[model samples]
Structure formats: structure tokens, C-alpha cells
Target: MASMELTDGYDEECFRTIVLAGSPQELRERRIACQSILLEQLNVIPIEEWMFRVNTMHDLIAETAVLICEAQMKEAGYGPPPCTYSFIVFGSSGRQEATLWSDQDNGLIVEGEPDGEKNRYFEFFGIMLSDLLEEVGYEKCAGKVMCSQGMWRKTLSEWKEQLKEWRTQLEWEPIRYLIISSDMRHVAGSTELSALWQKAFYEGFIDNEELSVAVLRNTVRHKATLNLLGQVLTERFGDYAGGFDIKYGVYIPLVNIVRRLSLLHRIRASSTLERIEELERLHKYQHLDDIQRAFLLAMRMRVNTPFSVQNGLLISSDYIAESELKNKQLLSELRESLLLVRRLHRALQRQLRSAERWRT
Candidate 1:
């Protein structure tokens, strides 16, 4: 990314090979190879560096895939892209926190009017790219956040209007979209367009006093990971019964609390760690060390959660195993993290209450 000077088991050569991959199949093979290498060094590398490596690999694969897709489009008679476009990602991929098994959460932002010709061309391009990525081991997003959907593949102007529509509603569904919008990151093409898309999103945010509260209302809808007695909550029943829902329980609650605080403090960052750092700088979040500590642990546990290798793809589950839960060190760290999450959760509740009173 910044430079190809990676060290300590992060194979710069493998990463370069991914960039040089000739076909989607080549990329897929390279990705599988890279995944093997990373898994072997999973515990050896720190989560921070591991995350950097994995997500950077994702960026390169996606970028190279874009190049291949563009050439294919030309060969298939579509000519060039017709206009500048940005390939953007959402959720963990957007925040640069993708684990080894993260799925696709992406969109295409085109640089022109919503004309029939451009739309038709990019629609084909979108489906091709999505299919290629799936072939490269990324499962399509279940919610259809991928660019194959017209709702996600839009002209820049159309995207702005969509943002406005989401902001205006402030309902649960629209609020969720607004939160997702905050995580958008430009992976390929037209970084300038990507910057503008994000700028418009936040610029509107600066004026919408009610928007943050609406976001807060939505942010607090997380599943609780800790009980009143400061106990770690595990799944009561299911395939993962007795195992902790590391994703929803610990990771997401922490993410949501920090995200809401970031919005309130005008901290414009997609990465949750970056948001926490800025909030600390602003003195908006005092529990900085704890937050970072717990967050890293949460990420580590999330990545370490049970995963299966099926079809050369790392299929990850969001829950830690009940057996793994017995690790004394892990339990200790998790309890501390959940406690901080609980504290931040209460803090967010207070902010929402105050906002509601202000409205009253």
C-alpha cells in the first residue's frame, strides 16, 4: 500500500504477485496461497499488522480485478469505462478491518449523468466484477450491498440524492444505511470522486443537528454482551450455544458506541480505531487505552473464531467456540473489554437521553 516494504511474514512478493495476477482465476489462486501463508502466521503476527496485511491484500486483489474486468469489458465490445468510476467498500472492508474470511461489501460510483447507455454498460460491468470477485473467493454480500445491484451502483449525482433520502428519513432502516455510509472507502478508480462522495456525506452531517441523535437512536440497537452483574453473555441456544457471539456481543457494541461518539465529536474516520484516537484527542472519549486494548482483543478474537476452509475459501463464523471460552487469559481480556463496552453503552444512552430532552 503506502510502500511494498513489508516485513516479518507479510510476503511483499506474494502481494506483488497478486497485483500482477493475469486472470480472475490467477487472482483466486494467489489469494488462496496468501491465505495459507497468513493463517500459518496468524498468531505470530500482531492483529494490527495482520489486519493491515489482509485488508491490503484485499485492496490489491480488488484493484487488479478491476483492471482485468475493464480489459474484458473492452474485449467484449463495451469499450472503456465511458466515465470515471470508484469501486468502494462498506463495513469491515471499508474500515480496513477485514479478517481473513470477510465477504464482499462494495459498490461502484460512476462519474456522469444517470443515462441509459452508461447505466447499461456499468450494469454489465458491475455484474462481471461481482462475479469475478466471487470467483476470487469473496462471497457476495447477502444484503446485496455489492455493485451488481443498481441501488449500490449509481452515478455520483445519484449517490448524493440517495444519501439525502437516507438522511431525511431518519428511520431505522435509513439510519442503518447512514451508518454504513460512514464506512465507505474508495478502493479503486477516481479517488477524487470517492473523496467528494464522502465529503458530501459528512458536510451534510455538519448541518443536521438531529441526524446524530437519529444515528444514536440507531446505534444503541446493539445486542448486549454484558449483563447488569458485569457477566459475559454467551449464546443461550443455537448451533453456537454456550459460545460467545464475539461479533455482535463484543465487537459491534464497542464499534457502535465509538461510532456514535465519533459522529457527535465530528471525528471523520472510517476506522473504529482511528475514530477512538480522534475522540481521545478531542477528550470526547476518556477511556482511550481501555478502548484500544479491548478493541484489539475483540478483533483478535473475531479473527480467531472458528472458521472452515470450504471450496478454497475461509468460511468464518462470528462466534468463539465454547471450548475456547475456557481459556483463562481470553476470558479475563474479554470480561474487561465487555465492561468497557458496557460503560460506553451507558455513556451513549446518556447522550441520547440528553438529545431527546433537547428536542423536548
Candidate 2:
């Protein structure tokens, strides 16, 4: 009986051992578990506790989720064959700033034999992978903009065709796709897939005189979060009792504006910071550098905070309060970033109008 009791205690200790393990792999696994738990529990946590807890959890879960997708792909026979493929993540997931639950936004690029079977297999694998992700935690995209959706699943030729068609339309929805697709990052699978897409898109679309104008128009849909007096804007609901949607209210605008500019020039870098650098190299907007730096810092700050968890629960980032900005540096930087985004919006609006005239 004593031996049995001791053995049970050892088993319990073994389970806890992962959390305390010094190895990177062990800590990574533990982080994944902890992140999943935090995401599951974010609704109940107070806003003050957000920074450390929320951001950490978001990072862990994002990587873990991607890991799961890769494994599922192998199981589905979509693993790359000698050649290369890229499991591109788009939108929030692509940015690596995803909260507890974000919809599927992804694309694929493949460079393999034109064997119809291989293309079909890749599409089948992506669908299964997206479905598995939904089961694990992520919600299916309402518009079906997931790997599981037929529209989003495509071969290299199909993708090029779709892009050309969308460009020809130059409509609001297509413009939106162009912006979101700019955030893509190769998470796993064949790296070649992303490379091919990047090469093709940058070379084909950036210089397309007609498509550039449409994208610019789509970029400036919102105004600054602060009014002329410099007071932050409030909405009808959320934290601050009535505050703005930080994700959409601030971050997305910055992301969208930068993306439009980058895509217009075909910069080919997905990360915002990298995009900013690329823009600088192109000498497109010199005065905007400070603002770009501030915005990138704000995004880092927000993603590093726990508000994402709570925001995920509410299905919105607006509930995040300015009062939660306990760190003065982060708060100041975030505010500056928003202002920069606002400036960029105005600039984009003007550019779009010019582009429209030029097109005509």
C-alpha cells in the first residue's frame, strides 16, 4: 500500500515536470498547453492582468496551431513531394498576432508537376487541415476563406488565374483580398510554394497600372481614431464602457494602409516592420517613418498583452480599455501609432483619388 501511494505521487510529479523542465522542447510543449488553457480561460481574467498572460498565450497557440496544421497535412498525403510548397497563413494568423479565436485566412503555393492528382491532393489536405484546426479551437471563417473552402484552395495556375480575374474586376471585395493576402507568411509545408507566389505576384501585379488604383481606393475606408481635439474616439459598446475596436479601430487600419502601399509597389515582405523598411527603401514615404515605427511598436505591445484573450471572448478587441495601458511607454507609443495610421489613411484617400483620375 505504501509503495502504491509513493508510485501515484511520482506519477503526479512527472506530470508537473514538463512545466519545470529546462529544455526548450519541454518548455515549448508546456507553453502550448498553458496557452490553450489561457485562451480557454481568458473570458474571466481581469483586464489588468492582460499584458503578460494574453500575449504569451497568443504566441504559443498560434505556433501550436500551425504545428498541428503541418502534421495534419502529412497525414493527408499533401506533404510536399521532393519539390517545395508553402503553407501560407494570411490576415491575423499570418501576422502571428492571432487571439484565442480567429477565422481561417490562408493560401497555398505549389511548384510541382502539373499532375492533376497532386493538385487535388493538396486541396484535400488543406481542407482537412482547416477542419482539424476548427475542432481544436479556431472558428471557421464565416465567408469560408479557409483552406477547407474550395475558393481558397487552389493550384499555382488556379491562384494566378484567380488573381488576374480579381484584378480585372477591381471591386471592393477583390481589393480586400489583395490587402489581406499581403499579410501571408509561410508557416510550414513547402517553402517553394510561397516563394513562387511571391515572385509571381510582385512581378506581375505591382506594376499593373490599372490594379494599383483599385487597391489604393480600398485602403482608406476609415478615419483616425482621435478627432481634431486629440481625444480618443468611443464606440457604442465594449471596454471603457464605450470605446473603439482596437483591432479594427487602430491596428487593421495601419496594417491595411501599409499593405496597400507595399502591394502597390510590390515590396514582397509580409511582416509590417519588414514592409516599413521596404517602403523606406523604395523612398515612397520618408516622413512617415516615425509613425510606422510607432505603429509597429504598438502592434507588438498589443500582441504582447493579454487583452487579446479577453477580446477573443467578446469577439472584439474594442473592449480593451485605455485604462489597461498601465505601461506609459506602450500607451504613448500606441496612441502615436494610431495617429500615424490616421495620417496614412488620409494620404491613401488622396492617392486613390489621383489613381482614379489617372485610370480614367
Candidate RMSDs in Å, in order, are: 1.7, 9.4
* Clashing residue pairs, backbone N/CA/C < 3 A, model 2: 50-306, 51-305, 54-306, 85-190, 86-190, 109-193, 239-319
| Best model number under lDDT | 1
For candidate 1, list the clashing residue pairs, or say none. none
Candidate 2, residue 185: Cα displacement in angstroms equals 1.9
lDDT per residue (tens digit) for residues 138-242 in model 1: 989998889999889999999999999999998999889889878888899999999899888887788688887899899877687777788788988879899
TM-score of each: 0.96, 0.71
Model 1: how far residue 232 lies from native, Å: 1.7
Q: Which stretches of candidate 2 lie over 4 Å from their true place?
A: 1-31, 34-85, 99-103, 110-124, 238-240, 304-318, 325-335
State how far residue 189 of model 2 sits from its true place (Å).
1.8
- For 1-360, candidate 2 gives per-residue lDDT tens digits of 001121234333433543354333444455445555554544344322332344334334444555555555676666644345556778766665555445667765666445776667666666766665555456677767777665666667777777677778888998777666767777666667777766766665845877777777777788557878765665655345554456777777777777777776777777565677778887657655675666555554444433433312324343445456655765566677777777767777777788777667
lDDT of 1 at 132: 95
The models' CA-based lDDT, in order, is: 0.87, 0.60
Model 2, residue 27: C-alpha shift (Å)? 13
